[model samples]
Target: MDDTGLISRLGDVVGEANVLVAADAVAGYLVDWRGRYRGTALCVVRPATAAAVSAVVRLCAQAGVAMVPQGGNTSLCGAATPAAEGRSVVISLARLNRVRAIDAANNTITVEAGCLLQRVQEAAAAAGRLFPLSLAAEGSCQIGGNLSTNAGGVQVLRYGTARELTLGLEVVMPDGELWDGLRALRKDNTGYDLKQLFIGAEGTLGIITAAVLRLFPWPRAKATAWLAIAAPETALRALIALQDRFGPALTACELVSGVALGLVRKHIPGPHPTLVDSPWHLLVELSAGGDEASLREELASFLASMIDDRRVADAVLAQSGEQARRLWTLRESIGEAQRIEGPSIKHDVSLPISRLPEFIERADRALVEAFPGIRMVTFGHIGDGNLHYNQSRPTAGDQTLFLAAQPQVNRVVHDLVDELGGSISAEHGIGQLKRAELLRYRTPLEIGMMRAVKEALDPRGLMNPGKVL
Candidate 1:
C-alpha cells in the first residue's frame, strides 16, 4: 500500500515534525525490546492527544494502510513491532504521556495511554493511594502497552492484573472514530463491556489512548522476606501458610531458581542475598495498614515455624526499607539478567496452583531428557501459578545453533502445558511471538469468538495488523 498520502495527512493532524520518516529516526520503533522481531515502517507519527490519534487512524483506514500502535516499545512478544513485510505506519504514543486527573475521593487516576507505569504508581502514591500494577518494565513500559498485554506483576497475588485494576479505557477504533469509555465507576452493567475487547486485544481491535485506573489505599507498613527452599512443593506449603495467616496482607510470593538468581548476581551488579546453597528460593512480602515492627515480628515468627517444619532451609527478613528494596531488586532483575546472559527459549505459562509442583517436576525431567546440558532458568509469581520457565545453553556454543531448537523446545514445554490443563500464556498476550502457540493451544470455538469481535471492531484490520488474532 502507498502510504505517501496517509503520511502527509498524519503529519497534518499530529504536526509535520511529529512524523518521522528518516530510516534512523524510525528504526528504533520498528524493533521490539528483546531484539527478537524487526520490521519496516513507512513513518513514525507522534500524536499527543486522543483527537490526533483518531485522525491518524482515520487517514490510515482511508488509504488502506495498516498502523501499529507503539508505546515504550517494550513488548517482549513483538506486539508493538510492525510486520517486516508491510509498509505500516508506527503510531508512537510516547508524546501522549500525561496524568489527566486524579480523583482522590473516588480512588481513581485518569492517565493518558503513553504514561509510564512507574509514573502512574508515583501519581497514585502522591495522592495517598496506590496503583498496584507493576513489573520489571514499569520504569519504561507505558500504561497502554501494559493494559494491552494485561500485565501481571509481582503484586498480582493481591492487586490482580492490569485488566482487573483498570476501570475504563479511551480507545481509537480502527475506522478513526474515538470511543470515550473512560468511566471510573465500579459497577456499570448497561450493555456489552466494550473496554474488555480493547484492553488485552494488543491493539488489534483498537488503540488504547487513555485509561481510568482503579486505585487502592497505600500500605502503611510492609515486611519482606526471602526463603531458601528445597522444592516447589515446599514453597507451596509456605505460600499456604502465609495466606492462612496474613490473608490479604500477603501481597507477593515469588519463586526464583538458583541459576536465575546467579545470573542476577553475576550480571546485575549488586550484593546478592546470603542464601547461596539452596537450589530454590521464595521471595515474599506482607503489607498492611499497621505498625512496621509488629508486622516483621509476625513474619519472623512464621519463618521460624517454617524452619522447624523443615520446609524452609533458611530465611532472611528485611530489617529496613532499603533492605526490602534490595530484596525486591533481586526478584525484579531476573529478566534483565537473563537478557544479558544470552538467548534462551522463554515460556510464560500458568497452571492450577495445586498442580505447580507436578508441572515443574514433569517439565524439568522431560526437557533434560530431550536437551541434555540445557539450563532451565525458572522463576515467576508462583503465588498466582505463573512461571517464567526459560531454557538457556548449557555452557558454550553458537547462539544460532542453540536458538534453532526453539520450535522443538516450545513443543516439549507447551505440549506438557496443554496436558496439565494449563494456559500457554498467563500475562503476555498472543503477540507475534505466541500467535502460533495461541492457535495450537486455544480451542477453535474460543478463537472464533475472539475473531468475531476483532472483525466487528476492526473490519479491515488496519489497526496493529499481524498481532494477536
Candidate 2:
C-alpha cells in the first residue's frame, strides 16, 4: 500500500516506461484544457489495452488509491484532471487507440476508447459512411471523453448527441472488472440499458474502454448557405420554415451573433466580407441523396422564398465545395477568436427551441444592466436549442476584475435558463467546474437518485473522486 510498492506494481503491470512519476513528465495531466483547474497526482499510468486497464484498476482498488481516467485532456470543465491531494493515479488511454472493426453492413463502427474522434470519422468515411458526432476539438479529443461527456456538436440536429450515437460500450468497473457489453444490435429490448449509465457519468462510476457507434449513409449531395437574419426570433422562424419544407434534408442550422462573427473576423485571418452587416446570421446546410445540382436548386429556391417573405434579409449561397468550406471556416473560427481576445466566463446551456429568443433577450438585458459595457458573444446549435453563451470584459476593464464577477454573471444567466425550464449544463457534463451549480439546479430527489447509483457502482468512490456526484 505504500507509494513505492504501488508504483512498482503499476510498473510491473504496464512497463516502467508507461509509468510516469517525474513532475515534468506528468505535468500536462495536472491542469485542465482551460487552465481553470490544476491538480497533482501520485503518478500517471499508460495502459494500452482493456485488460491492462483492468489490472491497473484492480491494483489501485486494493491499495485504496483512487484512479482518475483521462483521454486527450481536452475536457472544457476539468472532468479528466486529477485533484490537488496527489493521492490518485491518472490512467491515460492514449496508447489504447485502435479501430477494432467497421461494420458497414450494420451501419456501425467499433473503436477503442483512445481513438481520436477525427480518426473515427475518417474510418467511417473510408467505409462509405458518416459518423456525425463532431465538435471543434474533434482533431484531438478522443472517443472515450466524448462518450463520457455525451458531447453534442454541430451535427446533432441531423444525427444526435454522443449518447444517441452510441450502440454499445465496454467499461472497466470501479472494482477492476471488465464488462464487455459491446453488442452492435439495434433492437435489444431486454433489461436496463446499462451503457447509458456510463455515457454521461463523467467517469464517476466506471471507465469506458471501447464503444460501438452508429453510422449513417454518406450524403452524396450537399448545399451550404449563410443567411442574414434580424434576430434570434427571426432565426427560429426561419428554421421552422426550412424544416417544414425540407424536413430531414436539412442537416445543419447554426445561429451566430454579429458580435461573435466580428470577433472571428478580427482575431483570425480568412475570407473577408463573409456576410453583410447583420445583427444575426444562420449558417444553413442541406444534404441529400439526389443529384448535387438538384440539391443546390432546392436550397436556392428555399432561400429565395425566405428573402421574398422577409424572413431572411440577405444571403450568400456557396457555389462550390471550396466556398462552402470557407463559409464554415467563418462559423468555426468564433471560439478561437474569443480565446485570443482574453479570458471570459463561458456558459453552455440549453432551452426549449421556442423559448431561446426569450432567454437570450432576458439574459442579455440582465447582464448588460448588471455589468454595463459587457460584451456578450452568443452562438451555437440553434437547431437543438444549445447555446454557447459567453461574456468578455470591456476593452478598458481589468481582466481579473471582470473574471471576479463570474458567480454573479452565472446567476443572472442560469436563473433565466431555469425560469424558462432549461438546463444550466446542456452538453457539457457537471465536471468540477459546475458541481455546485448542479446541486443548486437539480432537485433533491434527482440528486439522491444519482448518489444512490454512484454508491452502488463505486462504493469506495475510488473512480474519479470529486467529479460529478
RMSD of each: 1.1, 1.0
Give TM-scores for every candidate, taking all chains together and pairing residue i with residue i. Answer: 0.98, 0.98
lDDT of 2 by residue, 1-469 (tens): 8988999999999999999999999999999978889998889999999999999999999999999999989887889998888589999999989999999999999999999999999999999999999888889999999999999999889898999999999999999999999999889989999999999899999999999999999999999999999999999999999999999888999999999999999999875555799999999999988899889988999899889999899999999999998888888888889989998899999999999999999999999999999999999999999999999999899999999999999999988899999999878888898999999999999999999999999999999999987
Candidate 1 stretches with Cα past 4 Å from truth are none
Alpha-carbon lDDT, every model: 0.91, 0.93
Which stretches of model 2 miss by more than 4 angstroms? none
Per-residue lDDT of candidate 1, residues 231-330 (tens digit): 9999898899899999999999999999899888889986765765689999999999999999999999989988998889999999999998899999
